[model samples]
Target: MQDNYQALKEAGAEVYSVSVDTHFVHKAWHDNSERISKLEYTMISDSNKELARELDILDESGKALRATFVLDPENVIQTVEINADGIGRKADVNINKIKAGKYIASHPGEACPAKWEEEGDDVLTPGLDLVGKL
Candidate 1:
């Protein structure tokens, strides 16, 4: 996601990465790894397992699982995705999800359809019977 940081920010999203590694490990990777070195977002150390425990992402050895949490402005979790080891994440897909979330937030009573990618994309609205209650 480092490569798409600017795009994510432009989409009105703030990204924070939490890891089970120590602060020192985070710093070392940031200093030595080219990709990590280019990261511009915050990286939090969860070595004490505080966040991992709360999130219930701990593994057998106490390692945090790979997870993505999309939260609303009120800090309420809107969506969550957890992947097994070796699986990957896609920034563009997440960008679309964020866009759809923003659109839904503003356009009450309407919901984005499957494969919705942007603000002008097609959305699903309630029937006359449901009206604003949708």
Candidate 2:
């Protein structure tokens, strides 16, 4: 996801990474990890598990579950995805969802269907006449 940070930012969404590690540990890892050494987004430290508990993603082992949250400009959560350990997330999927969310926010009452791609053409505006048509 760090690799696609520019694309996400261009799509008008800020990216932040929250981890249960302390600031010192995070800094050390960030400085050492070759893959993430150039990460440009903000990294939030949740060593106390405050954010994890608030999001209800803390596990019995006191570790946060892998999760992603897309929030709108108003700070309201628009989409959320949680995964178990050993699972991974795709940046393209989240980016597409962010695009769809932004589109829906700008064009109220319209809905983007499954696998909706910003360039690909699939949007729905519901009405009584369209009932049971899909």
Highest-scoring model, lDDT: 2
Per-residue CA lDDT of model 1 for 31-126, tens digit only, reads 999989889999999989999999899998888999998888889888899998799988767787788889999999898876888888778876
Error of 1 at 19 (Å): 0.3
Model 2 pairs in collision:
none
Q: What is the C-alpha lDDT profile of model 2 across 1-134, one tens digit per residue?
A: 88789989888888999999999988898889987688899999999999999999999999999999999898998889999999988876778888898888878899898867884577888789878887
Q: Cα RMSD to native, each candidate?
A: 3.5, 1.8
Off by over 4 Å in 1: 126-134
lDDT of the structure predicted as candidate 1: 0.87
Instruction: Give the lDDT of residue 119 in candidate 1.
Output: 80
Query: Best candidate per TM-score, number?
Result: 2
